[model samples]
Target: MVVMWMVTGGAGYIGAHVVQAFLDEGMAVVVLDDLSSGHAEFVPEGVPLVRGSILDTPLVEAALREHGVDGVVHLAGFKYAGVSVQRPLHTYAQNVTGTAHLLEAMDAAGVRRIVFSSSAAVYGTPDVDLVTERTPTAPESPYGESKLIGEWLLRDAARATADDDAPLRHTSLRYFNVVGSGRPDLYDSSPHNLFPLVIEALLAGRTPRINGTDYPTPDGTCVRDYVHVADLARSHVVAARALEAGTSLEPVYNLGSGDGVSVREIMTTMADVTGIAFEPDVAPRRPGDPARIVASGELAARDLDWRMRHSLTEMARSAWEARRQA
Candidate 1:
């Protein structure tokens, strides 16, 4: 019998890439998304997509049963870190409460395994140059706090159901910056993310502005690990496969590039790759912006075959092509 997986928020950018990655491995995929931030076209043909929120327990549970879902890739949540600070309740409703509801549905349906799309925000501006799985979690925003809570919820659920025949096996992926595009039709549509913001500005014939050119980094700008979306997507599939085979895995993995690129370098690469020859305007740093925070992907590399396959130039070029197609 073939294994089937349900991808919540699979109509979004990262989720769409993850669906493709699973398809590449010959796993049957079904996507669940409310189309709030996700476009229906992003979902590939032939993959079953259910248009609904994960909070809708009956809807989520029905999708699982109807599709014979063996596992789930939970990716649906409100993800804007900055805006989450102002709208804490809304963030909690979507990420925290929504996660609780999904777990409830999973339990009701006896779904045994899940791969969660967590964020490095759980680390909340780490002090270490290379954050490990042991890094202390101190989320700075409601969004980060909600993701950390989601991780805890999964753990608690696993413990509660350990004695059952269908024990919950779960792993959360943590990363800082996700960029680039896997296909021409799919591109990052986030308003707050760096790559999309820059790409959109240039396309509108406006100069892209870089926040904080006076940070303590070598380039006097903030530095972050920007991983290619395709590479990140592949790791998600590997994690799912491991769970399907009843292989034991750590509770979490950081899909980070040990080293990182500064915002200035990103701008330069975009200019070179797209032949947009205008210099970016330098702006003051946003509040609570870290000077540098890159995590060690060693754990994920060992367990999930994770690695940064694309260079900065390649990431920029692919994203540019996708944006043009958008």
Candidate 2:
């Protein structure tokens, strides 16, 4: 029997990669995206695509039944942290309410397995240098809060289903900074992410503006753990497949490179990758920006057998390749 996989926001960056992974495994797949931030062209041709919001419960339930979906990869959400501060309500609607609708649809459809594309922002600024899955969540922005709430909902649903004699199992991968592109046909055009913006500025023959140069790090710039999108997507597949095979029961996992690279280091790597001389302008730090955020995904590696194959330079090269092609 073909396992039907329903991927919410499957047309987006990481979602597209997961969809491709499932397709490669010979699974019947259905993609649901609202196209508000995701592009339709990014979705692979010939795959089932449902252009709708996750908040639409009726539509989601209908798609679940029509596609015979057995599992779900939930990646749909309002992801811009900076924008979330400006429009908290919108983030709550898209991330919180939309997630609720998806869960309700899943419960109704009898789909008991899900792999959530969670964020590292849920940990905020941790007390320790290397954050683990056990780190206390202290999300600073509405976006982070929304994601935390989504995790809570997943846990609640899992409990509710267990009480109803139909338990739901989920794996929420908390990704830090997701950079690099997996598909040559797709790339992020948004000016939100630092990696994309750096590439774009370099391509335009301009200096990418650095947010701050007064952080406490050695380089006086903020540091972050950046993970390749492809690796992150693969982890989702591992989590989903494991759940289907009755392998594990962990609800959350951290997915990261473990080594924190500073903004200056990333800039240097990007310059080397594109052969473009970057002269970044020093700008004031944005409000609510964390000084440093890195994750230790030891649990993920030990449990899922996952590894980071892409380096800093490799990530910059792939991203630059996609930017140049676009």
Candidate 3:
């Protein structure tokens, strides 16, 4: 009895890795993506790529039924935090409204489980050094607000259907900065991500610029937790397996590495991996940029088999190789 899971936004960078992780474990998967930010070529052959948005209840419900989907890994949405500030309505429409519609379709089609793709943006600039699951959520951007709302939707939906036969069982994984490549054929194509921004600049014969080199950190630069996309993807499968086996899980899990790497360190590593030795340009700090934001993945480690399998060097090298090949 092989369980079939539908991965929304599976054609994107992180989603593609998740799809591959499921397939690697001999589980079956299907992808539903609108190709707005996802690339069709990133989707592996032989896996059904349903071209649609999660907002379309009829379309999502049809796909769930037509494929006999037992669970869903919801990852589709407008994910840019900075841009979300300017386009709050669009962000809410896609993330909050889209999640609501997905849940509705899941209920209509009797899909009982889901693993939502959440973000660390839910905790906006925490004063603490290491973020835990219990940190207060104070989202600054519309993107973060939408994600928090998505989690609420899942929680409330589960509460509402608790007495039902197939009560909804779900968990939201709040991601930090997901980087690196699981496969060379698949790479991060986002223009906003730090890894890609640096890669793109180096490729075009330009120096990578580091924003805010005056923070109160070891290197006077912002420090952030960077997790390998593949590592993060593997945990999604573990969480789904737990749900399928009737194992109870927390409503939300933070997928973090409990380690902080400074922007200066990242630039140095990028230089080492790419074999481009040049100093990075220092620029003024971006507004609202926190000095550091790392998290303890102890809970996820205990429950979801989460671990940092790759080092900072591996992350930089893999990302550079994938981008170079692309």
Candidate 2, residue 162: how far the Cα is off, in Å: 0.8
216-317, model 1: which lDDT tens digit per residue?
A: 789998899999999999999999999999999999999999988999999999999999898899887775466777899999999999999999999999
1 or 3, greater by lDDT = 3
By the lDDT metric, which is better: model 2 or model 3?
3
Model 2 alpha-carbon drift over 4 Å, by segment: none
Query: TM-score of the candidate numbered 3?
Result: 0.97
TM-score of 1: 0.98
Give model 3's clash tally. Answer: 0
Best by lDDT: 3
The Cα error of candidate 3 at residue 178, in Å, is 0.5
Candidate 2 lDDT over residue span 1-326, tens digit each: 88888889888877888888877767678899998878788778888899999999999999999899999999999898878889999999999999999999988999999888888889888889899888999998888889999999999989877876658988888886788888787676766889998987877778998899999898999899998888887788888889889787578998977899999998888878888876789999876568889999899998876789988788888888886887
**How displaced is residue 312 in candidate 2, in Å?**
0.7
lDDT of each: 0.92, 0.86, 0.93
User: How far is 278's C-alpha from truth in model 1 (Å)?
Assistant: 1.9
Per residue, candidate 3 scores C-alpha lDDT tens digits across 121-140 of 89988889889999999887
